[model samples]
Target: MNKLLLTLGFVLIPLLVIFALFMTNSVETQITLMCVALVTAIIIGFKAEAFKYDYTTFLFFLYLASFLGILCLIQFLFHVL
Candidate 1:
């Protein structure tokens, strides 16, 4: 359960943040997400350490890759229509 929560924490938080950003009409979406990313990184880092996990940096980037891959897939599907 701990691992699952950690995984979801690292994955969903940023996506949720970005989704929130999309709801706004701000012209600085990139900057907003960047700030959200930094805050979420701190949160994930601290939580991972609290659970005595290792290879945090590796896992972060791996999660990021998976997230981006999903985003690309979604974009491709949209464009294919």
Candidate 2:
């Protein structure tokens, strides 16, 4: 169902990023997965748009990317410190 896919898309992005971080010890891999998750979430949200000028889709991507970025930055800082 569309709703399920939409929900999965919402959930999987962060999950994948975390998984990438845990599975790979490389910052590059984590960043790559974060970007991939952001793009995939954007595409999925766009496709699942059920309303005009759906701002929720934009917010979803924004929040996801921001969260991922913050997580990666924290990890990097900890690594450097």
Candidate 3:
């Protein structure tokens, strides 16, 4: 179940981004959806250790999530004020 959810999360991340881009016109809504997906990915990455995944891979995911999260914050700020 964990592996399945992890796999589904990875798949859904991109799908959520695409959906946010094409389906939503509001910048805030798009950013909100993206942040939600990124947070989910981060959670799954943290859980990967139980499945014996590599530490380096988890760090990489963490790095990517942080970077994207920062970008989302900036975008939100710009969109808002």
Error of 2 at 12 (Å): 1.9
Stretches off by above 4 angstroms in model 2 are 50-53
What lDDT would candidate 3 get against the real structure? 0.74
For each of the candidates, the C-alpha root-mean-square deviation to the true structure, in angstroms, is 6.3, 2.0, 3.3
lDDT of 2 by residue, 1-81 (tens): 768778988798768877888988888887888888878877777677723376776775787678888988997887789
lDDT of 1 by residue, 14-63 (tens): 67557744654443553455456656655765666633546656566567
In candidate 3, residue 72 scores what lDDT?
68
Clashes of 2: 0
Candidate 3 displacement at residue 19 in angstroms: 0.8
lDDT of 2: 0.78
* Runs with alpha carbons beyond 4 Å of true place in candidate 1: 50-53, 56-81
> How many pairs of residues collide in each model?
0, 0, 0
lDDT of 2 at 53: 71
lDDT of 3 by residue, 1-81 (tens): 777877877898889877876788787888788888877877775665433656676676677677667766776687779
Residue 70 deviation, candidate 1, in Å?
18
